[model samples]
Target: MSSVAKVVRSARGLLLRGSFKQAATQLRADISTGPQQQHGTFYEFRTYDIKPDHLSAFLKLTDDNIQLRTAHSELVGYWTVEHGGLNQVFHIWKYDSYAQRTAVRAALAKDHDWMSKYISKMMPMLNSQDSEVNYLVPWCKLGKPPKQGVYELVSFQMKPGGPAVWGPAFQAAINTHDSPGYAQLIGVFHSEFGDLNKVNVVWWYESPDKRAEMRHRAHGDARVVAAVRESVTYLVSQNNKLLIPTAFSPLN
Candidate 1:
C-alpha cells in the first residue's frame, strides 16, 4: 500500500480506538504550522471527501474562490490525504472574529461566479454524508513564525463530559513545561462543523528533536498523565507534514 494509505489507515485506527486522552496527547505531538501565521479566533477544521474526477475542480475552486476571495482569515498550510483515508482534503483557515466569519460566508455565498463555477464543480465529488467541520482550539503561542521543521497534527474528539476534567490537566501540563522546542499554546474556537463534544489542540515544535523532547516530557509529566487518565474517552487522528505557506496568499 502507498504511504498516504498508511497514514489514512493509522488515523482511522486512532479514531476507532475512541480514546480522547490518547487522541489529545497524540495530537499535541502532531502539531505543525505553515507560512501564513495569524493568531486569534482561528476557526474551522474543514475536511472534505471529494470525488476523484472532481478533485482538480475542487482544488481550482479552493484556489480561486476560498483561497483568493476570502478576506476574513488567511489561508494557512494544508495537507492532502492520499492513502489510508478515502479521498480526504484537510485545511485550516484563520479568522479574526466571529463577525468576520459570518461576513466571509455571506460574501462567498453571494458570489455568483464562485457558486456557479466552483461549487457546482464540487457538488458531484463531495461526500456530503460524512464530511465534517470542527471548531479548532488553538494551542500554540502567538508571535513571529518559528524556524521551519516537521510537525505532527493530532486532534482529540472529546467525549460528552470529558472537557471539564481534561481541560485543567491539559492546561497544567502546558504550564509546567520548560522544554526547549515547545513554543506557544493557543486556544481555537471551532465553528460551523462537528459535534460539540470535541475540543482540538495543536502543538508547535521547532524541530523533530524538540518534538521528541516534548514527547519525552509528556511521559513524566504528572498533569498530562492525570488528564489522560481522567478523560479516556475520545477519538484521535494524527497527520505529520512539513509546514509550507501558500505561495500566492498574504500569509507569506
Candidate 2:
C-alpha cells in the first residue's frame, strides 16, 4: 500500500478502537514534527446585527475603514447574511493566541483611526453583536474554493461531551461529501468559547443553485447518507446561513 493508504488504515484502526482523542493526539504530534501549521491559532467568529436601514452604510463604512482595525490583527473573511439571518454581518479574525487577541483588542481600543473612523461611526448602526472563538479541527486545514463564490456557515450544536464524543463521526460525514467532490469544504471549527459543544462547518460553492445541486448529489450517495445518519445522533440542533463575501473580505 502507498504511504497515504497506510496512514488512512492506521487512522481507521484508531477510530475503531474508540481512540478519537488518541488519533488526534498522534496526528498533532506528527504535525509538530514537521514544518506545519502552528497549533495555538484561534479564529474568532463575530456577528453584528445591523439596523435594517443602516446596513448599506455599515458595509460601506467597514469597507472604507477596516484597514485600521485589521492593522492590529488578521481578518480572515467578512460577509453579509443572505438567508437564515437578515441585516447581519459576519467576520472571522485570526489570532495566534488568546494573549494576541487581548492585545489586539487593547490596541483597537486605543487606535484613534479605528475608534473614530470606524467604531464610532459604526456603533449606532448595530442592534447587537456576538462573538465565538473556535479552533480548526485537528484533521483538517482551511481550504479555498476553485474561485470566489458564495459561502455557507452551518452551525451544529452537539450533545454535552464536546469533540471527544462527536468529532469522529461528524468529521466522517463531512469527509464523505468532500471526497465525492461536492461543494468545497472551507473548514470545520470546534467552538472554544461561547456556547460549548458546537461545531461550525463552512462551505463554498459556485452559487446558491450549485450548492443545491451538490447537496442533492451528496444525498444520493449511500456513503454520505450513512455517515450523516451516524453523525445526526449526536446533534442537538443546527442552523445555517448563506453568506455573500463583502467587497474587502480576504476570502472574496
Best-matching candidate per TM-score: 2
Give the alpha carbon lDDT tens digit for every residue of 1-252 in model 1. Answer: 533335446666787888656655554443322122344455556667778777666666676666435553566545454333556666666667768878888888887876786777777779753424444434444333454443334455554433333444444444554343344433333323566545554445565576677778776767667655544534343333333223343322
Off by over 4 Å in 2: 1-38
Q: Candidate 1, 11: how far from true, in Å?
A: 42
TM-score (C-alpha) between model 1 and the true structure: 0.55
Q: Each candidate's TM vs. the true structure? A: 0.55, 0.85
Provide the lDDT at 108 for model 1: 83
Clashes of each: 27, 0
Q: Give Cα-based local distance difference scores for all models.
A: 0.52, 0.87
Highest lDDT model number? 2
What is the alpha-carbon lDDT for the whole of candidate 1?
A: 0.52
Residue by residue across 1-252, what tens digits does model 2's lDDT show? 433345557877898999998877775554334222348998999999999999999998888888888888999999999999999999999999999989889988998888888888999999999999998988889888778899999999998855655666888899998887887899998888989889999999999999999999888999999999988988999999999999899987
Cα error, candidate 2, residue 240 (Å): 0.7
